[model samples]
Target: MPALSPTMEEGNIVKWLKKEGDTVNVGDALCEIETDKAVVTMESSDEGILAKILVEEGSKNVRLGSLIGLLVEEGQDWKQVEIPADVGVPSSVASPTPAPTPAAPSVSAPPKLQHQPGKLQVRLSPAARNILETHGLDPSNVTPTGPRGIFTKEDALKLLQEKQKGKPSELKPVVSPAPAAVPSPSQATAVTSYSRPAIPPISTPGQPAAVGTFTEIPASNIRRVIAKRLTESKTTIPHAYAAADCAIDAVLKLRKELAKDDIKVSVNDFIIKATAVTLKQMPDVNVTWDGEACRRLQSIDISIAVATDRGLITPIIKDAAAKGIKEIAASAKALAKKARDGKLLPEEYQGGSFSISNLGMFGISGFTAVINPPQACILAVGRARPELRVVEDEEGNEKLEQHQLMTVTLSSDGRVVDDELASKFLETLKANIENPMRLALN
Candidate 1:
């Protein structure tokens, strides 16, 4: 499977668009691959006949560069093509023995084990199985609490906890129970009351007790990847943050003027333009750390962080320093749409010299964003709230004036961008944003 995203090590085959023995042309979509970031269509780059389908649909975690299928030339028999034994093939297609005749039962079908009446099959989810194995519990004895009488992790955990508390399993005995051991309804209710976990009283006086049950759904691939990357970033990267309160009255004025011409612009678009100019002015801040030395990029490709249903993906606006404010605005809008739709290609989201995350539209005052790997600096944009400032009048008299103040936090990799360099970059960004007209020239 092709690595559709930068951090994608494996991909899940959501569906196959083409079947075996199909005549596939170049640029044809062979399958839909669900990567950590999105579900992307994997198009074929080479034209050939799809000879054999290896990985079946819904197969997950298919390693990158592994053989998933065969594309053979016309007039060539695909069955004659010998696959090397060392090359790992998908489990669905790899077979050592010859094919069985149609009379034989399908070997691919899963074998079902018979159970006693009213007993459930010993099927457990990954989490449930792990919990049971870890706690030395048998799956056959554990009660299935999930939908359709399937065992769930919560059921396994609750059973383990109850056993530790000296409570017997609630499952009915396979054999007939003795009459003396049978508990009455009152006794069973008392036992349940004793086994139930204690709930602390509400801190507020005269408040009703709250009751609830919760289910733990497995995390999506994107969420898991995000967790892993964020954990690594927090632990490995030495981050230093610096904040600046920018006076954006000029930007607001410019935006209003632009709106008069039917050109819509957002605070984030201005921030992106200003950041690009600042990066161009201070190239030292646009650098990444290599093990041996700091690697500085020639072009300023700014990654704009966009949150989608899958996760947060940053699509790059390449050569942002060379693009105008209007162009940046248009590109940013299109990129954000593409990101949400999961239609962005690898080159669009893979690499960048810097990143900008704007929470201003959401009315956030200020917050720091974690620096994406290989991007030395990330600028976090907050809402531009109006603040009263004391100003000098033409007569030299002091007067109060309302100005829109925007807070921006710069998170930089300490190894690549020192405090002094980061401070200079933020200062330049503030100047550019406050002046507003300077961005027009660039």
Candidate 2:
């Protein structure tokens, strides 16, 4: 399992394009790995036959450098090859054993534990243990379906599922007793009622009450990664926010004029370019917080946050400060396309010195975004709306003026970018954006 991204500690095998015994050549896409940001193709580095697939597809959180599969020369009898002990396969899967029979179980009762040698020493995966404990089930009652008689989470879940199907919806404790413990006529006929806990109705105001039960949909790999990163950013980073109202009347005119020249651009493209230029001017605000030192990057790469059906991904535009307006606009379009298609390479979405998250297209007024790690700041862009303001003319007569106003919020890492530095960065950004023509030269 190779680290697909800089922030990735583990990767999920989305799918394997090649199966065991398939021929592989250099540059061949061996599998798709779901990383922290996007699904990337893992290419084979050498020509060989796929000898084995040790980790199954859809297996998640496999550690970096863990053995995922093997490659061998042609006609090498790959079947005879021995798998390493540390290849991550559980011992139970490596060697199968028959499940021990319940010694004192009644004919019609659930499986019961018996005093057997090594029974108390059964090995279980963390997932299996958690599942067993959560469902109030016992590992001894679950049949070992993993290699070397190891109890696996899948085995526990299977038992629980089967029990749910055979028994009541409410799980009951499995008691080891004789089948003849059946109650007599009057005892069996006794009325019993269970008091159910009050359930709060799930509904929206002004809407009709819900009539049907809603099913829980498991989060996708991308959604899970988003949740984890957002949580970590909020919990670990000491974030300082600074907001500024910028007049974008000049930018609006510039965009229209650029369209006439066939250099079509978006507000977000301008924002990204402005951000990169400002980072170059305010180098101190572009540094990252290393545990021991402040690491300032030399390049002015900017991460542009793009929302896709899967999740949010930030594809980097490397050295945006050196690129022209047309170049930046074209690159942003291409990167956003690749991000939505899940084809962004590791280098395209990995490291950057700053980030731009634009929610203007979504009609959001303004919002403070959590900073992406290893980058000191993130610029949140809001919609440029028309607002009325009073202005004094040359004659000193007060007049109501309409201006295109936009609210932008900058979220900075307090460790590296202080309040003053963050405010200065925002000020520079506002100037470049408001001037509009200055961006063309930068």
Residue 217, candidate 2: C-alpha displacement in angstroms: 3.5
**Per-residue lDDT of candidate 2, residues 281-330 (tens digit):** 88887788766679988998999999998889899999999998789999
- In model 2, the runs with Cα more than 4 Å from the true position are 6-10, 18-23, 50-136, 143-157, 165-216
Worst 10 residues of 1 by lDDT: 96-105
- Best prediction by TM-score: 2
* Clash pairs for candidate 2: 92-146, 92-147, 92-148, 93-147, 95-148
What is the C-alpha RMSD, rounded to one decimal, of candidate 2? 8.1
Candidate 1 residue 243 Cα shift, in angstroms, is: 1.2
